[model samples]
Structure formats: C-alpha cells, structure tokens
Target: ELFQVGQEVEVVVLDFNENEERISLGYKQLTPDPWLSVPQKYQPGTKVTGKVVSLTDFGAFIELEKGVEGLIHISDLTWSKKMVHPKKVLSVGQEVTVQVLEVNVENHRISLGLKQATPHPLELFAQKYNVGSRLKGRVTNLTDFGAFVLVDKDIEGLIHISDISWEKIKHPSEKLKVGQEVEVVLLNIDLEKQKVSLGLKQLEGDIWEDFFHRQKVGDVLKVKIARLVDFGIFVEIMPGIEGVVFNSELDENKIENPAEVFKVGEERLAKIIKMNPANRKISLSFRQAQADLQKKEFQKYLETQSDRLTLGDLLREQFKNLSSKDNSKKEGHHD
Candidate 1:
C-alpha cells in the first residue's frame, strides 16, 4: 500500500563500486525523517490517539502516525495495578488515547502513558474519601499477613492481619475470606507508594479503649485464667483482652510453680495494679485483690462495733499487738 510497482521514486545516492558494478541506494533517506520533527510535534503532556501495534514484556508500542511510534511502559498502562501486561489491557489495532510523557528524537523513542490520558485513580479516590473514611469492599485475595480488598473499581486496599480484628489472629484467612464483603475504615493512603491501608477492626472501635473507659487502676474484677506459664498466669479480664498475673502477685506467700495451683479456665478475683493503654497492657495482682477485700471487711466490722470502742482505743489495740509480736521475736532470738 505504501509503494506502487514501476512508480518513479526519488532516491538518495549512497555508494558506487565501478569494478563490481554495484551501487548502494537509499529510498527512505530521500523522504523526510519522521523523528526529526518528533521533538517539536510530540512534546511532553501532549494528548494523542494511537493504535496498538505490538506488545512486549516491558511495554506496548503505539503507532501514533505513519513512521512515528511511541512506547507505553507497562507501568503507565494503569494507575492502580503495577504488574499488568499490555496484552491484557490492549490488543493490536485497538485505538487508545494516550498522553505523551517523553520524546527522545535522537533515540527515535517517545514515552507514552495510557493512564496519564485520564485522571489518576488514587487522586480520585482521595477526593472521594480520606483517612478514617468508612466504606464497604469485597475481599479479593488473602495472604498470610493481610487481605487485599477491592475498595474501588481500580483501587485495591490492604487490610493487614493486625487490622483484621481486635483479637489476635495467626493469619488473615481466620477473619476474612476471599470474595466476602466487609466494611473497612481507611487507615492510610500512601500516595507515594500508590497503596491504601484499610482496617476492619477500626470499624468495631478499639477494644482497649472501651476497656480503659469502664475500668481503672485498683478496680477488682473476676478474671478467667487463659494460660499458666512458668513465670506468670495470663488471665482474661474481658473478652479478647488478657492481662498477666505475675508469680510475685499470685499470692502474699511466694508460689514456686503456678501450674500446680492455677489451672487454665479457673476464675479468680484480680486487682488492676497497673494499666498502660499505650502498649495495651494491664498488670493484675491476685494477692492485692485479696488484701483489698480483707481491708473492706475489717472496715465493715469496725463500723458495727464503733459504739463499743472509740477511735483512740482501736489505735492502742493495734499498737499493742505489734509490740507483742516484736517482743516475742526478741525473746526467741535470746533462746
């Protein structure tokens, strides 16, 4: 179609060898070089329509015009996905609108972007939503560490295992399944990495926050022993919240082995000795809880007998008991 038979075509003379009667001739050189005017014609950011001519692992070749083709790197094919192949998105002879990204006339190369022709999906997603925004999405895939969810047509957000639920989970599959629809909170948008972080647990609210709101230090509550280790006993103060009862806090008298005395699933009263919401940790003491109960009982007993003994008499009685204990220890030492 480009050239006709017997058509007189002007050609550029290249070389002549009279001895062998051979003369090298050029026809393309006689015509204007398309690349010579490419620098001015195809400036960066220029919008143009082209036909997909070829596909490769690296990118797709788009024929902008006769003798002028540009390369659309696989990355520029889409704004949301990173590993898309050109054949999957485009086919030979398919017309596509593209934006000129770069033009190197010397190398006869022009970089084109299929995605740059339209608005960036991440930019549009950011406009419609923000960090902390809640939306419903379908789980596309699950990995050991997290789940990928299709939040938007082109945007897939990640729900890390830690963000899957308030309860500890070994894998994301425990809480989420592929193709399951779920509500998620937008935790973060990393524009630089073109990634969106989402959280399912955030929609439920922080369990630790609710626990700290209703509870405080020195408060006593019955907790079930979840695990009994050599050094301490892990007890669940509330559902999905565990605190440790150290060996030292197990009893007023030292406990050498907790397993012998404390069994898993057994319930015991524990006093909240310390609460650290920053690290989501609570330290409970079984010994202190018992002591607090004893103090309350003694106060109640004193109230009932207040008329019999005044405050001064009660103080003297307590002092006399201490003095007798010290004297007994001294007498025993002498013996």
Candidate 2:
C-alpha cells in the first residue's frame, strides 16, 4: 500500500532531512486532534453516547469518537446495586448513554457516570416517605451493630441495635432475625447519605413515662439485682424499669467487692434517692433506706415520751441528771 502507483493521498511530513535528502511521512498526523475541542463540545452534565471499548478492574472506557474516549468508574454505575465487575452491568462493544461528570482537557480525560442518566432511587424514596411513617419490612441482613430491613422493593433501611428493644440487648440478632417480618417506625431519612434510620422500639410507647408516673423519689421498694458492673449494680425495681445502685450506696458497711455482696436475683430494699425521668435513669441507695427506717423509729420513741411529760418537768429532770454527772466527775478528780 505504501508504493501504490499514482495514489493521491494526504501525508504529514514528520521530519525533513535536507542534508540526507530524505522525508519521514506520517499518516495519523494528517487528522486533527479530537481532544482539543472536547472541553467545549462535552462540558460537565452533558449527555453523550459511546461504545464500551474496553473494561478494566477499576472502570470501563467508552469510545466517544475515533480519538476521544471517557471512563465510567464502577462507583458511578449504580446508586444502590453493588457491582463487583463491569461485565456484570456492562460488556465490551455495548453502546451506552452517559452523563459527562467532568472533562479534563489538560489531561485529555473525561469522567462519565451511568447512574446519573436516571432518577436517583434515594430521592424517590424520600419523596414517598418521611420521618414517623410506619412501614412493614422484612429483615434481609444482620450485622454486629444493626439489621438491614427491606422496606421497599429495592430499598433497605437500617435498624440499629440500640433501637431494637426497651431492654438492653447484646446484638440485633437477639430480637431480630433475617427474613423475619416486623413493623418499624422511620426515625430519620438522609437523602445525601442515602441512609434510612428505622426503630422497632418506638412503636412500643415509651415505657419510661409510665414507670416514672407510678414511682417517685424517696419511695422504698424491694428490687432484684439484674446485673453487676464494676461501678454499680443494676436492679429491676419493676418490670422493664431498671435502677442503678452505686458501690458506695450498696450498704452502710464498706464493701470491697460488690459482686460478692450482691448476687443476681438477690432481693433488697432500695430507696429511690434520685429519679430523673428525662434521662430515664433511677439512682437507688440501700444505705439511705436503712438510715430512713432508723430515723422513723427514733421519732416514734420521742413522740411517746412527749405525751408522758410536761415541758417544764422534762427540763427540770434533764438539769438534775446533768448535776449528778458533774458531781461524780468532780469527786473522781479530787480523789
């Protein structure tokens, strides 16, 4: 083809060696550089069609023209679906319409997105649902921290372990299992992060309010120890109502080891020394309850003596007793 007779064609002179009388010819240099006009023709957000020229571990390259090409990273392939390989959603030589996310003319690169071609699923879900909306969902997956429940056909929301029950649980699996049907309240919806926070305990009215309404500070009640920690002992004063008795408040006697002093299921009279309904926490003290009982008995004894003597007679009796004590002490000192 290089030595065809009488062929009229375009040739770009690469180098002209005048001293050697030789000319280096280039065929590709005859065509204009397509990248020079890429920025002006394909700005960010511009819609373009291209062929999937090649695939790589990170992304797929789309050929926009003979000399122009763009990259569609794996992350920009879909909003929710997790794709391991580009071949899962795309193939070589497949024509695809993409949104131009960015165009770097200086580097001769174009960044394209496939998911941007359609409406975002998160934005659609937000428009349909709001905070406090109750919806039924199936637990699809479970993790150490939370459970993922499929609320909509394609969307899933997270139920944190803390929001699973009124009583403390070690993990979400304790109350929820995969494929279990449950009702949840939408606590929050974050469109930017594409997160939906759901709660199962919110559906059950706040039990703290009911428990606080029936109990008050200074009330003494028999409670069973539920758990023992280094700082204190957790006791259940009533069903689902737990109170903490610090190590210092465990008893009037100094206790070095609370675990030995208070065993699980052991019952003791605890006085509600501090009750905070706002924080849903109750502070109990066994020492305070014992002291209060003793004070009550002493008051009863004083009341009985008040009825047996007049004020003037009581004062005279007290003065006579003090004089006898003083005389005895003086006699001992003189001896």
Candidate 3:
C-alpha cells in the first residue's frame, strides 16, 4: 500500500511464503462470462454433455465449465422411479451430459434435468421392440415379484416369478443370477405408463403343445415325478409338459401318503387320463394305468403257461404208450 503508482516495487511471490507454500490461489485470472454465452450455447430443453466430477447425497456435481457447475437433483435422475442411491448410477470422475432446465445466476444455481437428457425407457423400448418381442439381456435388479432385465440404457423389463418358468419357481434367484444374461419375451408393454411385462419361459420350447399334439387321453407316456406333496405328485412328461397325479390317482395300497409313493427325480411310466390345454393342466393316472398294463401282462403269462401244460400232457401220454407195450410183451411170454 505504500508503493507509489508509477514506482517499481519488488514483490515476493505469494507461493514462496514459508508458512503455506503448498497453497495456490487464482482470483483475477480472467475468462469469458458463461451467462452471456450460456443463452446461445444451450436453449430450453436443449441437451448438452458435461462431466460428472463429484456426487453428493442430494444430487450430483456436473462440471459445465472448469469453475462452473450445475445441480442435477436426484429427482431428475431418471424417467422411471428414481433410484435410491446416486452411487448406483455414477461414480467419481465420470463424464455425463444433462439438459439445462433453469439458469439462476443471481442465486448461482443451475438446475439440470438428467431425465430429459436421456430418452424415457418406455419410449425407446416401444420404438425398438414390439409386444411379444424376444430379447436377451442381463439381470440388473430383483424384487419380490420380479426382476428387471437391462435391455438397453433407457429400457428395462420385469420378469415376474410366474413368468420365469412354466415349471413352478420356488424363487427367482433359483432360476437366474443378478448378472446372468437370459432370453426373455416381452409379454405386455405400456408406453403411456412406461411399463413392460416380460416372460422368461417363453424363450424355451413349449412342451405342452407337443404333449397335446402327440399324445391323447388313454395314451401311456413315461414321466418323471418332479415333486411330491400331500395332495398329489407332480410328474414332468417333457420339458414344459407336466401332470398332476392326484392322491386318488395313486393306489392307496401302494402309497400311504402321495409323498411316500413318489420322490423327486424319480422316473415312472404314466398314462394321461385327462388333459386341459386351456388351463395348461394334465391329470395323470399312475395306478389305473399300471393296473391295466399288469392285467395285460398277466393274461399273456397265463396263456403261455396253458400252452406249456398242454405240451407236457402230450409227452406223458406218449410215455404211457411205451410202458403199456412192455407189459403186453411180458403177458405174451407167460402165455
């Protein structure tokens, strides 16, 4: 402050100060005003790219410039339900582009729209795929009812546990892992509501169709009993073709409890006593069918025994004739 306006004053570099030499500062360094240029560079609803330099609990720090930042609320994170944690999506040092929603320079607040920056998943999926469309994707998230397949950046579809398999599914994780890529079918799509229902069993072949076509009532087919319960035994005739052998179908003599009659992973020949394609059900009769087969086999065995007995009797008559000839010879000699 004591130096004259024109007089030369030798000033020590502030960085060389012994106490805090590690510190660096920039204040008067000049740059073009973003407010003057931001009007032209980005218009309302215009999408632009930026870097995600940092993240916070409330929102994300997106670097619009070296010193300028825009606040992208977690609410604007996605068109679908906003994720709970921002860390799930972005990490430190990630580059992202978001839309400029509002520019409040007086408050020094830049409102950003991340949802607008990306296309809504429903819109993208509706345009890209159709209902009944088959696609393969990685399992990204799981819930009680279903799991979401990450088909694309803006698209995810839900596969309900029932839709996971034509066979009964005890749990979703039993059928798929979090990162497993699986084939899926788009069962229903709601573009307006941004909803999508998916099915996994559709990817595999339909065994029931073949069962109804190749087999009929009174048709005996070999089936493997998959599960046994108090009420019935579940038998799988084919990959997707399964039948319920009720306790009534199982002979009470053979099984006290249906569970005792059949165990999982056991194979047995069965008869299709009833079928309902509309309900996707098949009623099997193991007892009645087995009895019919046993009757036929027993009858055949009896006929075979009868033929053998007749042949044995004829041999006995021939032996008797020889014995009678010797006795007549003895009688002639005595005379």
Best by lDDT: 1
Worst 10 residues of 1 by lDDT: 303-312
| lDDT (0 to 1) per candidate | 0.91, 0.89, 0.80
Steric overlap count per candidate: 0, 0, 0
Span of 10 residues, lowest total lDDT, candidate 2? 78-87
Give candidate 3's TM-score. Answer: 0.57
- RMSD to the hidden true structure, all candidates: 11.8, 12.6, 11.7
Judging by TM-score against the true structure, name the best candidate: 1
Write down the TM-score of every candidate.
Answer: 0.73, 0.69, 0.57
* Candidate 2 residue lDDT tens string, 1-335: 35578888888999999999999998877888898889888999989999999999888999999889999999988775666678888999899999999999989899999989877887788889889999999999999999999998568899998889887788898898999999999999887888899999989877899878888898999999999998989998866679999989988888998877778999998899998988888999988988888899999988878866777688899999999999999999999
Candidate 1, pairs of clashing residues: none
lDDT of 1 by residue, 1-335 (tens): 66799998888889999999999998878778888888888899999999999999999999998899999999999876558988899999999999999988878889999999998788889999979999999999999989999999889999999888877788998888999999999999988898899999888788889999999999999999999877898998876799999999999998777788889889999999999999999999999999999999999998978855787798899999999999999999999
lDDT by residue (tens digit), candidate 3, 244-333? 998888873656766655678988878888889888889998888888899899999999999999999999999999999999999999
Pairs that clash in candidate 2: none
Q: What is the lDDT of candidate 1?
A: 0.91
